[model samples]
Target: MFKSLLSDRPGTEPLAAAFRACRTHFVWAAVFSALVNLLYLAPTLYMLQVYDRVVPTGGLTTLGLITAVAVFALACLAILDWLRGRLLLRAGLRLDRMLSSRILARVVDIQARSVGQAPGSQALREFDNVRTAVSGPGALALFDAPWTPLYLGCCFLLHPAIGLLTLVGGLILFTLAWRNERDSRPRLAKAIQSNAAAYAAQESVAGQAEVVRALGMRGSSIARQIDQRRGAVAQQADAQLTGGKYSGAIKFVRLVLQSAALGLAAYLVVKGEMSAGSIIAASVLLSRAVAPVELLVGAWPGLVQARSSWNTLVELFAKTAAQDRSRTALPPPAGRLRLEGVTVRLPDTETAQLRHAVLGLEPGQTLGVIGASGSGKTTLARVIAGALVPTAGDVRLDGAEYGARDGDELARFIGYMPQSPSLFAGSIKDNISRFSSATGLEAAEVDRTAVAAAIAAGAHEMILRLPHGYDTALGPYGAGVSAGQAQRIALARALYGDPCLLVLDEPNSNLDQEGETALMAAILGAATRGAAVVVVAHRAGVLARVDRLLVMRDGAVQLEGPREEVLARLREAPPAMVAAGRA
Candidate 1:
C-alpha cells in the first residue's frame, strides 16, 4: 500500500520506510542536537554575567562558580554531539541492512535484462553514496541547519541592529550557495557520466587484454581510454573551480559581516547603549547562525548526488518488483517446452531480430539450430534459455509461462551456455559448481556435484592436469585457464544438476577436434538423460548427431525437418544459400 500511496516519492517507499523503522535512532539524534545547541548559549551567558555582575561586584567566589557551570555545560554539549554522530551512524547501518540485498538483486535484474548497457556496478556505487550521505556530515548539517533561525532570534533579543546585520550576511551567503548549486551542478553531472564511461572502457579493454595485445592495438586502446578520462577530469576541474568561487565569496562575506557586527556593537557600547558582553556574544551568535548554512553549502554536491542515486534506485526497483514470487510456488517443471510466435525486436524500432519463431522440444530430443551471421539463431536460443524475454509471444515450459516464473527457480530447471564463456574468479570447481558452497552444501556433496559435472563435460581429466586440480584459483574472466579450457568448464557449469532444458549457443566455437568430440558427447549425454537440448551452431557439420535441424535466414526459419533432409536440401540449394546454411 505504501508503494501506491507514495507515488510522488518514486523509490522512497522502501528507503523512507526504513527510516521510519529506525525513527527512534533519529529521534534521539535530534534530541541530542537540541541539547547541544542549547548548551552552546552557556558560554555567552556566562560572559555576560561576568561582565555585568562579577566585574562590578568584586565577588571572585561567584565568578568561580559561574565558570564551573559553564565548563559543565560545554562538557555535556560535547558528549551529546558525539552521541548524535553515533545515532546517525547507527541509522545508516540500519538502512544498509534493510536495503542492501534488494539493491543487489535489482542490479542483477538490470544486467540480465540488458548486458553492458546499464552496468550493475554503478548501482552498488550509488547505494554506497546514499549510505554515506545518510551518515556523514551532510546529514548532520541538516539537523543543525534548523538551529540557524534560533541563533538569529537570540541575536535579535540582544539588539535589533545586530540581528539585521546577521540576517543580511546570512542571505548573502545563502545566495552564493544557491548560485553555486545552479552553476556547478551541470558540470559535475557531466563529469560523473564521463568518468563512468571511461571506467567502463578501461575495464572492457583490460578484460580483453589478450585480444588487444594479439592485434597490436594496445597503444591505441590506452590512448582512447586516456582521452575518456581526460574529458572527465576537465569537467570535474570546471565544476570545482565554479564551486570554489562561490565558497570564497561566501567566506569573505561572512568574515567581513562578523567584524562589522563587532564594530556596530562596540559603537553602541561606547554610547552606553549595550554592555561589552553583548559585543562578544553577538559575534559568537552570528557565527553559530551561519555555520550550518556554510556546512550545507560545502555538502550541497553530495546531497544532490545522493538524491540522484535514490531516484535511479527507485526507477530500478519499480521495474523489477517481485511481490508474489516468494509467496507463490510454481508447479513442478518437466523438459517439455514451447515457443509460440516468439519475437525479439530491436530497441526503439520495429525491426525484429527473431520474428514469430515457433518451436517445441520434448524430453530426450536434440534440436540443432543453424544460420549465418545476422540470422536469428542466437536470439532464439536466448529466448529458449530464458535469458531474453521475447518482445512478443509466450514461451511455455510444461504449463507455466517462462517469463512469469521465478528467475532463481527457473535457473534450476534450465541450463544455457552462451556464445561467450563467462567464468568468474574462483577455483575451477567453484565456477563449474556455480558456487554451490554458498548454498551451504557439505564439502563432499559439492565435490560430488562438481566432479559429476566435469565428467559430463569431459573436463575432469583436463582439470586434474592443473596444479591444484579442482582447487586451482582463476583470475577475472577465468584468466588461469585457456579459452578452450574455460569453454569446457563453462559447459560443465551449464550441465550441472542435469537441468531439464539445455540450450548451447555455439558450443563448439572455441573447441579443437578433441574438444568437439567432448561437446558432441556432452549434448548426447544430456539428451540421453531426458534433458531437451537445443544446440545453436554456425558450422552445421558439428550438428550431424542432432535428431532434427533448423535453418534461419533474416530472422525467420527457412527450413526445419529431419537432420538428413535439411542437410540434403542445403546441398541442392543456391550457392549463397548453401554457404549461409553451412557456414
Candidate 2:
C-alpha cells in the first residue's frame, strides 16, 4: 500500500497539486475578495451623493436614506471580508495536507543519500513559506490588482486630469516594486545559502562538542561558526537595506501622488469642470487603485523566496522519484544470503572500500568475520545488512535480488547492529520494538515482541534494574544509560521479531565478561532458530561458537573456511606475523 502511494506519478507538479486540492476554497476566496473590493466603492459614492445632492437640496429624508444605504453596504463588505479570510485559511490548511508528506519523504531520502549534511532539511519550512505566500494579504492584493483600472476609470469619470495623475502614480509604484524585486533577488539567495552553511557549521559543533572540548578546539570552532553567521547576517542586511530603500521611495511617491491628485481635483472643481463631490470621490478612488501596488512592494521578498524554494523542491523530487518507483513485492526471505562479486568504492576516490568481495550463507549457520581495522569487515557487514549497496555486485536473499524488494520489507527480516550503537529518545520498549508504528504493527504486538527480543538478547534482567524498567524514558542518544546498557538494548532491537538474518558489527565492544557470555548465547540461540548470523569481531571470545571464519586484509578476503581449520592455520603462523594479524 505504501509502495503504491509513493510510486504513483503525481498527475501534476507538486505545487500545482496542492493548489488544485484547494481550488474550491481559493475560488470562493477570490469571489468574496472581488465583492469586498466592489463594496469599497460604496463609501466614495456616498460622499459624492452627499456633496452634490444632499447639501444642495438640504433634504433630510434623502440624507437619512443615503446614510442607511452606506451602512448596509459597509455591513456587506465586512461579511465578505470575513468570508475571504476564512476561505484563505481553509486553502492554506488544504495545501499543507497535500504537500507536506511528500516533501518530508523527499527530505529523508536526500539525507540518506548525502555523504555529509543535506541542505534540504528546511523543506518543510520552505513549504510553509509557499503556503503563506498563497494565503497572505499580499496575495489578496494581487488578486485585487486587476481591478485597479476600474478605480482609475471612476477617477476619469470624475475628471480627466484626476484620472491621468492617478495612472502615473500607479505606474511609479509598480516601477518601484519591480526594482525592489530585482535588487533583492541575488542578495536574498546569497543570504539563504550563507544561512544554511552557518546552520550546518553550528550543528557540526554541537555534534562534536565533546571532541572540541577534549582537544581544546572550542575557541576555533566558535570562531568558524561566528564567521559563517557573519556572512549570513551581512547578506541579509544588504538585501533588507535595498528593499527598505525601494519601499520608502514607493511610500513617498504614493503620498505625493495622492496630494497632487487632490490638488488637481480641487483646481478642476473651481474651474467648473468637476464638482466638490467629484474631487473627494476621485481621491478615494486613487487610494484604492494604488493599494495593490503598495502591497506588491511589501511582499516582493517573500514571493521571491517562495519561487526559489519551489524550484528546489521540484528538482529534489524529480531526482528521487525514480528511485522510489514501485517494484514487485517478494515473499519473505529465508536467511539464504549471497554476495556475488560485491564491490564498493569510497566516495570521491578510486580506492575500493570492498573489492569484489564474495560470500554466502545458509540458514542455521554462523560466520565470524575478523580483521584489523579498515580491512572492510564493517563494510562487508553493512552490505549484508542492506545498509550499504555495493558499487558492482548483486546481494540476494532467497534467490531474489535486493532491488526486487522494498527496503522496509527486507529490513523486517534482517537484524543489524552497527559498531557504534545509537538510540532515539523514547521508552526502552519503543527502542527495542524499533519504533513499531513505523512498521504498521499493533501496540500489543510491539509490546509482546519487545519483551521477547529483550529476553533473547539477554537484556531483560539488566533492563528490569532501571528505575522504570522497560518504560524508562531515554534522552537523546540514549542518555542516562551506560555504554554497556545501551549496547544491550541495541542488541535487543536488532534481535526484535526473530529476524531471519542477524548482522552484528563489533557488538561486544562495550560488553563486560557477563555481557560477552550473553552475546555468545544469543548467537547460538539465533543459529539454532534457523537464522543466518554474521558477526564482525576484534576479539577471540566471539569466535568460539562460529561455524565458519572469514579473515580480511585491506579490502579483500585473506582467509575463509570452517572455523577449526582457519584457527589451526593461524596458530601455525610465526609469532610476530600472528601478533600483527591479531592487531
Across residues 1-583, which tens digit of lDDT does each residue of candidate 2 receive? 0111222234225655666677788778878878888999999999999999999999889999999999999999999988888788788888788888878867765554443444467788777877787778766776788788889998888777888898888888888888889889999999878887798789878977878999999999999889889989999999999999999999899888878878888898898988888877887899999988988888888877877776666666765564556798777778999889988775676688888888889999999998788888988998898877677898999998876777667888999999987888999999999899676888889989999999999999999999999999998878879999999999999999899999999999999998998899999999999999999998888988899998887778777789988878778977643543462
TM-score, model 1 to reference: 0.94
How much RMSD separates candidate 2 from the native structure? 4.0
Candidate RMSDs in Å, in order, are 2.6, 4.0
Q: So what's the TM-score on candidate 2?
A: 0.90
Off by over 4 Å in 2: 1-16, 117-119, 341-352, 389-392, 437-440, 552-561, 564-583
TM-score, per-candidate, Cα-based: 0.94, 0.90
Q: Show pairs that collide, candidate 2.
A: none
